[model samples]
Target chain A: MAEEVENFEPKIVAFLCNWCSYAGADLAGIGRYQYPPNVRVIRVPCSGRVDPLYILKALQNGADGVLVSGCHPGDCHYIEGNYYARRKFAVLKNLLEALGLEEGRVQFSWVSAAEGERFSQVIREVTESVKKLGPARRMVKSFEIPKEIEKEIAEA
Target chain B: MDIQSEIQKIAARLLKNKEVAMVIGYGAGSAPNRTAPVFIDKEKDVGKLVFNRFCVNNLSLYLPRLKEKGKIAIVAKPCDVRTIVCLIQEKQIERDKVHIISFACPGLLEKDGKTLFASCAECAVTLPPVYDTLSGEAKEMERNEPFTDRVADFFSKMPAERWEMFKAEMEKCIRCYACRNACPMCYCEECFVERSLPRWIGEGSEVTDTMIFHIVRAIHTAGRCGECGACARACPMDVNLAPLAKQIREDMLNLFHHQAGVDPNAPAALETFKPDDYNDFIK
Candidate 1:
């Protein structure tokens, strides 16, 4: 179990807004800021584009952690995208928490296009928080065949 | 006059005046403990309209479904009126297209006819918030604590224990969309669950699928659920969905100071945002 914990690298899905967090990540790449590579980033046009369904789908599809990063308040390229996103994510996060999901399984942050260092720090913090919680077991959908179906198939 | 006779007289007057093309109200169900929604188009059918303890269904659910049927008058409980307000606020129904007929609700009974619905115990509104005409007089009834306050016991449990409880409740769901159908707020043209291109919910009653369905539904109804208890009563599996609804309701009130169905003109909590809203959850 000790070795398992040591070797278990968590898979984190990060949805980054195109105008800010995505560019922030690009800056991080250009500046050679070291950060964990476990996060797979999906760039959306705006933070508002990150539907709660997308986050839940990521968690359901076996991702250990999910992160959504957008521009700071009043910094949205679309004028008020992140403001709306902030409300949406706040409620989504609260709902997820109420359903008994671990505190770190889903994370939200605001990273501007110039904040490369902050983006790396945010990723590292999110990754460490998720690592402590371990793999997500709640709300994950396993695609394995049922025991009854498997037995029937074996017989056939 | 009794509530039923008053309701019938109102329905007859509305139909006789041709003010409403149809009057959607409750009629006797096959069982004594149940009431089914009935549409009264002619004055003769006004006698069929009844308002009793068995009138538990949220009649506003049919407004959006029957939108093209022309102007309609609905017999709504005070709680049901909240859903109509929510629908109007969401632009799902036009306020002018429908007439609301409500009365002082005496509260509703469970299907067994012996116990009061949990929603009734916490009900705060005895008079409809917005109505074209109100019928029977409302007598003040003692109200208990808010539903969210009562669910604090469930929320206070350890996260792991709460998860176990949620999982247990979710496991009992047979994936019947009765809860969705019964919900007035769930009037989406294409529900995410039924979309095949990007199937939001799994095919069968897998625990994960059921959990996601409820989670998304709760999110969808967050500030919009009127606490009408229609979804819980519609569940054939007897799964208690009140905890999740109450939790979202409490969060909406705490975070945005918004309650669903209270004001027809107020914007929905999720549809609009305040620049200085709470962001303590964000990093």
Candidate 2:
């Protein structure tokens, strides 16, 4: 049972902006850098397009961790998309932290297209962090109806 | 003259002169110490308009609905005026088409009448920021505490405790959307909650669904919310939804040095960005 538990791999959802972070991840692949295969990447047009709902939905739908990566400040392909995204991410992070999802379950990073090695490093770190926290039990929706509510529905 | 009578006279004059199509203000509700929104088209009905601590509805919520009805005269509190400013800034309503009659509020009492509402206690403006006409004396009130005091207190709690509190708060939601309806800023024709094709959130009273509904709503109102406390007050279950909005508002001030509804001509915080905006979290 201990070995089975130790072998558990965390499922991480990564949202990478099309301009910078996605290319960075691609470069990581081209470089053949070895990293955890736990991440599932979703390429967005820009970091600004990554709405808080997307992150929340990922967690709700059973993602063990979420990583949102974008262009560095002043380097957005859209000029200021990452700037707006920065403000939004700050607020969302605060709210999520306050709601108790552990410290590193959700993360943000700036990875340029040229920084392939950095991309792999971020993924490895995120995977390890989420692995340490184990599977997310809170905020994941359980489809089962409560016995009391089931009884009420049957009676009605 | 007392503030109540002055407001009535102003509303009456505006209606009598046909200067506006209608006047939106508060009137006595069925229960004692309750006030309902009253629309007065006739000058004589202006007497129904009253001002008191119980008049807690952010009257600005009615502006967008009445936009196409022609020129309107709205009786606005300082906080309600912020909503008007936001609506005008968003172009939901034409500034020239509506006349504002604003008042200096001392503070408002909760429905119980014994204590001041949390929003009222934290109010930074006693006088309307912009108005065509004004009433009441500007009473000096001091805010010894920070605007984000309540949110900060909640943030200081352990993650488990905060999560438990959040769950407890969201559990009472019945998906009525009264909070949305009562908000002036929530004027989206196809609210995300109602979307179907790429449905953002499921329409269910389950805890996760309800939480998603609220979390999205709160995020939608991030820098745009005027902090009128209408959403929280409108919830029949008394769920405290304002803190989420307030937390964002605090962030807007701290991160961007911006406050919603303060300057009509200024661009929204999220719509504009500085290259050097705070981003230490982005590693």
Candidate 3:
């Protein structure tokens, strides 16, 4: 079990805004940039569209790490969507940190459509940080019956 | 004159003139040392209105529900008035329809009447930000301490210990949703929690679900919470919800220098953003 635990691979969920970060990831793929295979991408219309609930839901569903990326500060497809998103993200990040989650478990970054290399670099960094932290235990919901309850059921 | 008789006189005058269709104020609850919201439609019942240390309910929570009833006259503390400002800014209620009778709150007492609710103890705004009439002379009180001290202390604990504290709090939540119901800003016709087509959150008091519920609720009310302490007061389990809400308020002030309900004309912090809002956390 110890040997198996040493080989643990992290699962990461990345929420990328459709106009920029998603395009950047696509460009990374088209450019054949090598990056970690840990992240599963979900494209949203805007970074502002990613409710904090989505991040919490990903964590609650047992993802080891979550990343949210969007257009650069002044470059949102919508005039000021990323600007609004930046504020929400700051508040959410602070609240989550205060709630006691490990720092690197959730990340925020700017990845424009032109920066394919930066996208891969962020993925590499996020994967390595989450791997160092190991699997998330806090905020992960367990559906399995309690051991005592299982024992009682067996006796009954 | 005592504040209670003053409140009764004002309520009677409002009812007598038919200036308001109804006046929402506090009355004695069935239990000792408790107060309940009373909706007085008749002038005679103005005598039932009371104000004291026990009037802890943030009556603005009822504004959205009562807006359709008629033009309303509400008794508001400084904190409750903040919620009213939020409600109006959110377009949940119109500014012109309701008459606000606000007072200078001398901090609320706990059931014991000695200790103050955490929100009230550190309250800086004792006078309402907006009111149609004044109930009493605005009292001068010094705000010496930041209200987030306790929350900041909790945040300083180890990660494992903090998680334990959060889990313990979640375990005590019975999903009564009194917190959501009591919040003036949570006036959605269809809350995300109730949506079934694409159920956003699971309906359970399980630890993770409760945590999600709270986190989502806190984020939703992030810049808008008036710090009225109504949610904490309404909780039968005493769930220490102030810290979570206070954390958002602190972040708003720190990041945007914006305080909710302080300026009715300014856009909410989350709804509008500055070009150079803080983003040191972003890569």
Candidate 4:
């Protein structure tokens, strides 16, 4: 288990808002910033579009960590989109914590299109925290072959 | 006259005058200690409407579905009326189309008729927040310790242990969705769980699937839950869902300073946000 933990490469899913965090990530790539290659980014039209279900689905589907990034307060291209997202994430975060998800498992951040370096720094912080927590076991779905199927395979 | 007679008289008058097309209220259940919702449309049938401790179901759950039946009257406990106000706020039902007949609730009892339900023990709203015609003067019941205080030890445990505790409770869920059907806030015509296109979670009662269903349901009903304990009562397996409901209620109250179903005009917690809403959790 210790060796497994040592070799663990956490799979993190990052939902980046198209106008801001996605562009910021592009800048990070162009600037060649050195950050962990752990996160798999999915661009969304707005951070407000990140349903709490998406985060839970990702976690249930075996994501070690999830990050949601959007425009800084008062800078959402759609005006108050991020503002609504802030309230939603706040409630969702509290609910997740209440259900025993670690504080760092799901994270929220504001990264304007211009803050490319900050986006890289956020990724590093999220990756480091997730690495310390190891692989998530709770809420991760598992599939087991039916007993009948297993017996058939054995007979075959 | 007792509150029951008063309610019947008012209901009869409403029906006699055609003030409402139907009155949705509780009737005698199959057993002595139970009550089932009954729809009455005739003045003479107003005798079927009864109010007692066993009338625990949140009758407001029928409001959204009953819209096509024309104007309706409902018997509401303080908690039930909150869901009514919530439905009106959500625009699921028109405020004017429904008449609320609320009484000063003598909190509901368990099946044994000895103990109060946990929700009534912590009875927060003694009076209906919005009522068209109230029947009796609501009496304040002695407050039990807050639900949060009851779960403080669970919260103090490590995250993994807490998850185990919550998962144990969720494992009892058979995915019958009795709780969902009992909830007035869950008015989505096609719930996300039923959507095959995205297939949000597995269909059967896998532990993870059960956990996610309860988790997402709690999240979906976050700001809107009335803490009415309807869902808990509806669970045939007797899974204790009070903790998740209470936690979300506490967060909604503490974080947003909002209590749902109280003021119909107040902006919904998730739908509207102040420019300076709490976001310290964000980095």
- The runs of at least 3 residues in candidate 1 whose Cα sits more than 4 Å from the true structure, single-residue gaps closed, are A1-3, A145-156, B143-153
Q: Which segments of candidate 4 are over 4 A away from where they belong? A: A145-156, B143-153
DockQ values, each candidate: 0.77, 0.59, 0.74, 0.76
Which consecutive 10 residues in model 2 chain B have the weakest lDDT in total? B141-150
**For candidate 1, lDDT tens digit of each residue in B63-102?**
9989898889999988999999999888888999999998
lDDT of model number 3: 0.87
Q: Specify the CAPRI tier of model 4.
A: medium
* Candidate 4 structure quality by residue, lDDT tens digits, A9-109: 89999999999999999999888887999999999999999998999899999999999999999999999999999988988888888878888999999
Candidate 3 residue B46 Cα shift, in angstroms, is 0.7
TM-score per model over all chains: 0.94, 0.92, 0.94, 0.94
Please give, for residues A1-156, the per-residue lDDT of candidate 2 as tens digits.
457447879899999999999999999999998899999999999999998989988988889899999998888998888888888888788767756657787899999999999999999998987888878867788878899998998984
- lDDT of each residue in A79-119, candidate 1, tens digit only: 99998888888888888888788888999999999999999
Candidate 1 or 2, higher DockQ? 1
Q: What is the lDDT of candidate 2?
A: 0.85
Error of 1 at B281 (Å): 0.8
Q: lDDT of all predictions, in order shown?
A: 0.87, 0.85, 0.87, 0.88
For model 3 chain B, the run of ten residues with the poorest summed lDDT: B141-150
lDDT of 4 at A100: 87
